[model samples]
Target: MSTLDAWTHGEHTHDGTTHPVYRRGTGPGVVVIHEIPGMTPEFLAFADEVVEAGFTVVLPHLFGTPGRPVGAGYVLDTVRRVCVSNEFTKLATGVTTPLAGWLRSLARELHAELGGPGVGALGMCFTGGFALAMMVDTAVVAPVLAQPSAPFPVGPTRSRDVNLSPEDLAVVKERAAGGCQVMGLRYRQDPAVGQRFETLAHELGDAFVRVEFPGRKHSTLTLHRQQEAVDRVLGFLDEKLRA
Candidate 1:
């Protein structure tokens, strides 16, 4: 049986856009947005870790085949689709993806149901910077970005972009100033991450928690599977959501 079979399946809609969402566990709510090439077994496993940690975890299927294993062809196909999807801001600088609105709505719904201080949001790879954008809503208190590779990091301009529009960035800055810390994980030598971490630091100041692993691995929590990174993510969620 597929790992997803254990979770409850549902759909979330916002502004007329709907997406499949898989949920499990029970406690504070956390939304785990999958990376490019869809929700692979490794991604589900990482979500399972969060579920085992005591929080209700929700995995939103953005693209690719569910339960699909990571492969070159799958990755390429998904990348092509996402690049043409208006829901994302692939190569755009200073603009929030339209999909973030739906994610924020999901976070709000989860927070409304769970009724904690707020909900946690984590995005990986192609969707990595999304969590930070979702912070525009107060419901998302704990936002984690894992190897955020947005705007494609093609040139110096896009490479350094944090993937938030001017207006949204202002609000994020306010939230950061108000003590909503944003956590980020990446490899120091990962070219895909570009200079966004530095941009985040400059934008959010100390409110941005930087966790850099050694060497050059793309996915910090999955594929690469760093135990230390996983532990830190869970610890951050626990500290922010459970506390």
Candidate 2:
């Protein structure tokens, strides 16, 4: 049985593009974007935690088979698809992924419906930096980036890139300066995450909350599953959205 069976499913269409969305829980709204290779059981478990924490959680099905467990072959296949997809910007710097616009639209609609200060956006792994990109929109108040690996981290330049265009980065910086805080979590030695956390600290200064765990693990909220990180994320959402 798929864990998603308990959630209400729907489709969100924006600018002629549409994607399946799974929703559950109630209270404030949160858009939880899953990592590469689809929304695995672990990912759904994390979303369940968010839902149980008192927020209405929305999981956007971007790629990969929903409910599929993570495996080497599955990861490779999904990586290939994401690399070829026009919606994602894999090896490029100074540009936000096109899918972020769709995600921002979803956040907007959620905030509009919930009528709170704003909604929260959390992205993990390959889709990690997306939360920061969505933060460009005012609808996203609590933006959490968990092990954001983007631009492929091929070279030194790409390794440090946060996957945001200069224009978008500028707005994010402005928003950060205006009291909007961005939270990030990753393993201290995870090469997949590159130096993006350092870049974030440099770019957003104190507005960027950096959370690092010991050792080398990729997914902070899911696969790696750090309890402290999860608590930090939930606390951040509560502080920014409910408080």
Candidate 3:
């Protein structure tokens, strides 16, 4: 893989702070939200692949809680602060809220930069619902949610309530009804994501496409499964975004 500097870099003003964002590629825009690892090497490779597939991608540093930059690899400590203390989901939701506005601004700017309609956004496990949240941004035409995990507060009462506020869900639901396809990926074993899909399916009606990677686990659907998880996700994105 080749390392290319983000053509655009700036402070993403969100939640009373300015976080950094890396923008690369030269086609349609794709907002690539990283996993709990921040912008790790693997996630960067995923971003590069999306770029190679002909889409500009933006990687956001959602975990900006001091000393936590992109690719920090502070997973253990992150767990303590985020998961154990439940602050991780809180931090993530804060950024997810402002991200929709940031994407719209980025999309408009990128459209002038790349000369296209707008951008496509991909949110992974820790950030899967983020993509759904950004669907309210008109510039975000194509949205893909991959293994959305966290705050499994979904049931008949809170299914579409993970990370996103109720207002965001209503708007995104409207977009899906108007032809925006929300494609979701998850391993049946990942209960958090499974519950997410269950709730979202109802609010989204028939516009949501949830694909379960059989025998796959919580780890990217690559663990314990012979099938390649990356290939499956890429194919799904290609079908959805590569139009």
Global lDDT of each candidate: 0.93, 0.94, 0.63
lDDT by residue (18-105, candidate 2, tens digit) is 9999999999999999998889998999999999999999999999999999999999999998988999999999999999889999
Q: Per-residue lDDT for 1-243 in model 1, tens only? A: 237989999999999999999999999999999998989999988999999999999999889998999999999999999988889998878899889899999999999999989999999988999999999999999999999999899989998998999999999999999999999999999999999999999999999999998898799998998999999999999999987
Q: Which stretches of candidate 1 lie over 4 Å from their true place?
A: none
Candidate 3's residue-wise lDDT over 1-243, tens digit each? 223354466566644555577877765667777766556555666677777877667777665232233433576565455555422443333234444565556555554665544567777766677777777777676677777775444453333445676677778888888888887777777665646677778888789876776654664632232245556656665665556
* Cα distance off (Å), candidate 3, residue 96: 6.8
Cα-based TM-score, every candidate: 0.98, 0.98, 0.75
Poorest 10 consecutive residues by lDDT, candidate 3 = 86-95
Flag the better candidate by TM-score, 1 or 3: 1
For model 1, the run of ten residues with the poorest summed lDDT: 1-10
Error of 2 at 210 (Å): 0.7
TM-score of 2: 0.98
